[model samples]
Target: MLETIRGLLEGKPGDAPAVLAPERETLDYASLRDLCDRTVERLNALGIGRGDRVAIVLPNGPEMATAFVAMASAATTAPLNPAYREEEFAFYISDLGARALVVAEGMETPALAVARRHGARVLRLRVPAGAPAGWFELEPEEGGGAPRAARPGPAEAEDVALVLHTSGTTSRPKIVPLLHRNIVASTRHIGEALALSPADRVLNVMPLFHIHGLVAAVASSLAAGGSIFATPGFDAIRFFRWLDESRASWYTAVPTMHQAVLARAARNPEIVERRRLRLIRSSSASLPPQVMRELEATFGCPVIESYGMTEAAHQMTSNPLPPRPRKPGSVGVPAGPLVRIADPSGRFLPAGEEGEVAISGPNVTPGYESHPKANAEAFFEAEGRRWFRTGDQGRFDADGYLTITGRIKEIINRGGEKVSPLEVDNVLMEHPAVRQVVTFALPHPKLGEEVAAAVVLADGAEVNEHELRRFAAERLADFKVPRKFVFVTEIPKGATGKLQRLGLAQRLGLVE
Candidate 1:
């Protein structure tokens, strides 16, 4: 992993300009390398070394990116969102057994208070204006016994590099430990599937804290010797301007972001034409086929939808670039490793059969950290190979294209009939007035559970429960149609910005 990071620092011929930050200042290959080296030195001086756990709580920006590369160079990097509350921070800090917590200088973040409560060392990162100032800072303990020396040894392929918390949709988040081999394998596959090269320039708006941004956007780009334009967050207006000014060739984001971009495309035709993006990548959440087609038509580029999770270290599969017949609803073929669908009995189902998706490869983590129950239930041995259960239902078509139907737990059961909430949501999204839609299960006296939907209408557009239900009825069966519709300004999202289906019923007072 360190070798890959170092290799990117040595700019190859035909490489685009160094990675830029429209939000912050840009960093060339040499400068990024120096920052990584110095950060390693600082960490070592603070008694952190190989295999130690260091927790990071920062926003998405240059500091977050630099900190990730630096920590992975020496010790295990555990990056968490800065928005976590005090209780949430306390749980993760104590759970991960972190040796130290990294935060911004003078910032009163929850991690700092949680670190002090758990007796974990607190490291303040100072961000310089011109230079990378927010680089991690290590504060030595009082009466420090013998300054610990930093180990400059290379990271082994099997060494654990990152420990991430799953996006707790149904329950509390579990820690997923990813090894150096996992990172390298997954990023290499994504780079290959995207045909990334030194000539490529990626416009990365995804949050750095998630696997999608860390590996797919940053790591993959670096591995390919390509450059990235890192934005602090997704801004539709600024995104269009940067797309033109930076001349970014490609970009990656989630479905919500794609919708926002598509909304702005009509006003930004000149910029889009001038930039001529190679492809637009979507992951994390399923992208509605309607949105995919709209984005492609608006931008004049293919929208590559991918299947990924935190346990897989970002990407499991991606739609092949042009000339490969990008499927609208399909997530494309398996990219890095072997992908299969298994029935409830743990038997592998053949192609064209819908079942639980399982993956096996170097990119897939061995198991969760200190999560024996999850490990036992999620992993299974088949044909002398260990496979990780993705808990997602999917199948391969005749052409080997993968389409994820929905999550196993996210499926809504009406009476005894099984219905995919994603299927219902996708149909509702096509309504002219519907801007965003989330389908979930609501409790019913007779049916046990009934389908319910929450929708956000487009600006100045009017929609009612009667019209919405009528719209869904046209595309779905009576049982599949939502029994109740709730018009809301926004839907609730989890920490990673994914819609939480299980909690929606309870939060909306639909369950007693």
Candidate 2:
């Protein structure tokens, strides 16, 4: 069991590949460990050391992956989305009280200006020509304070390793700090769930800024002595080609990416056959049973759907691989933490009863950083243990398989009856013409809120609202069926490619 970031790299064979990218040299474990050591020394010299926050704004690829691992081992790392505007960058840099900002050489982003204005040192990540993927040097810019830090060394197991803000769909984003112990526990859980080993190679397309990508795809793979093929980002058009080149045994992504790959799987039959994946993993959002079934049929591999969030490092529960039954709709049993259903007051709920999902374990964060009110509402002491509420409504079956119905804030209340958008979305997905569907709440004069859906039809497939409503009505209760259907080419997705239901009504112009 890896207890710290340094331990994650030390046990791996020195000569084994740790990171790889398309058409780039591979970074071996020995060099990767050396990078961490050198990176810590450089940061110490620059006055940024353990407990200091370093904001990384770089495009997704080997550099982003490598920087995260090396920097987190040295100091606290906060990776912001490179696509953020100046205002967004300003808010995060200031909110995090970042000591430094890191950007790739020749890269242009608003973070550069934001970092300067916020009094944070700007460091340019320079990748040497013809260098191994993920090898880089950090050069400080001409501004910021002198070289000095209170704590100067590699981070300990209890030191804060990563910090990320909540999506804040309903309110202001809250800071979540994860210790090295939290991440190491999570990576061990993911590695164990997937049965990872040195022979495994992962094709990672999830954005490096997100927890799913950072912990599940990068850290877990490296911790298992496996290598990850990092990509620029998720590009549906270029997925198969990369798969063929990387020869990855498996890959993990959100459901949207899986659907996109399935859409293009037919054109690249040879590549699909040549790279017969060991298994496919989905997380960050619910994986529709419809999409899961299609993915398994196309890839001829088991589709392992997992549940995760930033508050819990990354993975909380996952469908086990092989020999064990993988439930289609359920996120499967607890993989890393003690997952359970709790009532409103925090008491445990019996199996088969719907309630808020709660977890308590080593991977769970201590609490939200510096926000006492939010922390009070987010955590509760129960059964002699502190459990963090997941804000997700779910229930467990007799067999202990957990099925998440919907987000607590995302559930639609029609007059008095509660409706889960996920339930409606699942039924609508059963329609042959529906490629993707996001069920949301549209404000209604009498009902307060009415169920509506945005549907994306499959290629050359057509269906009217009446036909789709009829299909959904057959499976769902009348109140749960979507009353209004809006057909579109593509449903809008969040930065991490998740469909946001909380504000979808306003985003789609359905709210008036």
The lDDT leader among the candidates is: 2
Lowest summed lDDT over 10 consecutive residues: which window, candidate 2?
A: 141-150
Compared with the true structure, what per-residue lDDT tens digits does model 1 show for residues 1-512?
43334344455543234567765556666666666677677777777777778998877776787778777777788898888899988888988999888877777887887898888788777765566322334554434653574554434566677898877766888889888778888888999999998888888788877899889988888788787777677787788987986788899888888888888888988888888988889999989889998988888888899999989988898889889888887899999988999987789988899999999998999898788998999999997899999999989998889888899998877889988988888899899899889999898889878999988888899988999999889989999999899988888876556666777988887676
- Alpha-carbon TM-score of each model against the true structure: 0.94, 0.99
| TM-score of structure candidate 1 | 0.94
Kindly list the per-residue Cα lDDT of model 2 for residues 190-217, writing each as its tens digit: 9999999999999999999999999999
The Cα local distance difference test for each model comes to 0.81, 0.93
lDDT of 1: 0.81
Candidate 1 deviant stretches above 4 angstroms: 1-17, 23-25, 132-146, 149-152
Best by TM-score: 2
TM-score between model 2 and native: 0.99
lDDT of 2 at 389: 96
Error of 1 at 191 (Å): 0.4
